[model samples]
Target: MSHFGFENDIHSVLKLDMPITNAPMARWQRKASTSTSAHTGALSPSKSANRSLSLSKTPSKTPGKNGKTQSTPSNAGGDRFIPVRNAKQMDVASFLLSKENEPAEESTSAQANQQANQKAWSVTLNGYDLEEAKILHLGGKPLNAPEGYQNNLKVLYSQVPTPVSMKKSRYISSAPERILDAPELRNDFYLNLMDWGRQNLLAVALSEQVYLWDAAQGDITLLKKMEEENSYICSVSWSKDGNFLAIGTSTCKVELWDVQYQKRLRCMDSHTTRVSCLSWNDHVLSSGARSGLIHQHDVRVAEHHTCTLRGHTQEVCGLAWSPDGRYLASGGNDNTVNVWSGAQQTGVHCFTEHEGAVKALAWCPWQSSILATGGGTSDRHIRLWNVNSGSCITAWDTQSQVSSLVFAPNYKELVSGHGFAHDQVSIWKYPSLAKVTDLQGHEGRVLNLSLSPDGSTVASLSADETLRLWKCFEKDPSKKAKPAGASSSIIQQHIR
Candidate 1:
């Protein structure tokens, strides 16, 4: 990107042309212009010559006649021009010519100084040490030091340390410590998958089907194929016990699937628009729709939805259920976050500080009342809110707009995924919001993310049509702490 009149590494030179001075000619011209007046003045030729001699000799002290000081009258131009006593002693003409040329040299020097300053201040990411790369300094005399010192010592050296090249980080190929891939289903494209049930077997939700994989036995089988009229499934979730699965679709209908029996238990037609997000808290399944309405379906009941919560004035894009099951949080295009409880039509609290559409929301599992919401805007900030007071507690800025968010099962960490800035997933610490690490691998927008039950792994679904599992590396076990300056790298080789 171009900045501060600089294009890439080159700056266009600006040429300024200034007229050279003619000081000697000016003096001669002035003498000629005032010759008639000087001749008509009181002093005679010899007196004027003596006056000039005295004036040159005693430049500071005024000349006096007969030991009495005489004031020098101002010229008609209201300014006194001192004449050169010996024009031959000093090359007056040459001196004036040199003075005229000095500005050009000074201007060239100034340009060189400016170029030096820019080179000293130019910033480099250190990802690659290119030939013309320059290091940046915050503020110090070291950057402005002479060329000899600058060449030997790099200012702010630590700030721009060299990055290890990709070729050096050995990419190892091995079976994933955990794999969600199943063999039974068609497996055209992986949509969303989860591990639920006491056994924690892999259960994947696809375009129109759900599959179950037994990793211990290496067996894959179809759990259920959703058969809803005119509906294309968009999202799915399993109950905390994994006994039931909640499926949401384009028709805005939600269906409860009995995984054990492999049959549909109930179907709900509550939302008027397509469902964008789905969350389940035991028997209560909450579905957020494009119409900005949140419908809670009671899986215990077969025929209808239990209640509808409304507050958002635009399409609802994200939803989360507080671990305690007391509150449900929803965010939408209206840039408002609404917290719902019970069958109440009025939201308990409304958070509306985001400048753009809110895309994802997550409730901290450990802190039942703390809710985090990320918006789809260039600002790329995630805001944490105190549900009770409806006030923002803190906000953390990211490099790209967040499309999905999930708190670590242990609640010590928060993860967010951006669509525009690569498919990199960033993990941050709670409260302090310090960046822990960034996982890179997916080449498309990460639309869904979830932390495993043990908080040891994370699963991210991307538009690249692949599912990635990341193993969380907590350097300090006692405090669930991360390394001070640790960062994550992509595992290029896919798990077998």
Candidate 2:
């Protein structure tokens, strides 16, 4: 593939075109021609002057401007004179030789300095030894390269590169390490049926029961089972403290259970429809219902329902609170995402970019305002939005229904549970939006996905009624994290 303008070497990029100077070359050329004509006795002016004895045989006196007579050449005495060894004769001959190349019609500026230039040349040439003088006039070599010598292009092959470690991964594994069965796991599209707690306990709502499975110990404890006729656990969320688990039921009441004591501490009963999504911000447990009402419950107080956000039309299936507890993002089956800032009951901004139900809502752990939401089958786009500006910053086509989106706690990569043509979990390399890999063991839709505090392990609950634990995001032991397999016992309970 052609890289357009980018595939060039450093030389082409900088364009180092140094100007070749001609001033020095002109001076050297003139000197060479003059020297060559005298040696070869060519038809040039210097050769003609030498053949006829235009230079004087002896120095004669000429009247000077100062009336102090100066010695000068009188006239040509003969066709040739016997060569003399005297230094004065050689000096005169050198002076005459220097002037032999000048044209009669040359500039007067050159003629004015003729005598002085000749005297300098005469003195300089005689000072050099005969051996050194012979070496000085190397007239045989061509000064520059002969005409059409183009530089041959040597195709550059890069050096044998040091093998780069292919194992260096910024995100967790794309493949799941183990699969656990969450039998009777609901196949609903609008319910957030599972969550991983910071305390290593995974809370999953399987049909009518909300089970708290000890992720650190290979044991499962039935936390709560709906006995109230038609009511079933629809959603599950873990509080920031990890000691508490919030279970939302079809009856529209949210039960705050104390994980340590194994008892219901509080029940928030304000919603009219089934509570589909639950998110926690400090002491506040915000629950969204099928009625599209968002009730904020401060669990520590009796008047738990402090403020109610009214915006979504359909069932609110996806919910997330920012890490700092400043903003709340919620996605609904109405195909809209709402950003609720502060304690306001009304959504500050509403986004309707998805054509299908917007059920996957994730707040970036690294960025406070960036919210990532995924659409259903009709809209298979995962868009990153800036809540403050109400603008969609970037989007990616999952090419399948995006059931869930969760960013890795340690790396920027995002894990998306998909349905349709690709009923698998795909991990993407963050902002680059490149698919790192896909975990593909589930036979059906991946309904929900949760990440461990270690950042590497991800638990996927699929519609196939199987819960998979992927060390897909397992990190290096040297990295700042809980020791590897510190909670490996969580997989000890064999679920056939």
Clashes of 1: 0
CA shift of 3, model 2, Å? 74
User: Can you tell me which runs of candidate 2 are displaced by over 4 Å?
Assistant: 1-175, 477-496
Please estimate how well model 1 matches the true structure, expressed as its whole-model Cα lDDT. Answer: 0.65
Error of 2 at 278 (Å): 0.4
Report the C-alpha lDDT of model 2 over 352-383, residue by residue, as the tens digit: 87999998888889988888899999999999
- For each of the candidates, the C-alpha root-mean-square deviation to the true structure, in angstroms, is 20.5, 24.8
Model 1 Cα lDDT, one tens digit per residue, 357-419: 786788887888899898775557889998877788998778677877888754377888777
Write down the lDDT of every candidate, Cα atoms only: 0.65, 0.77
The regions of model 1 sitting more than 4 angstroms off are 1-199, 214-218, 226-231, 343-345, 409-411, 473-496
* Candidate number with greatest lDDT: 2
Model 1's TM-score against the true structure = 0.57
Return the lDDT, model 1, position 20: 39
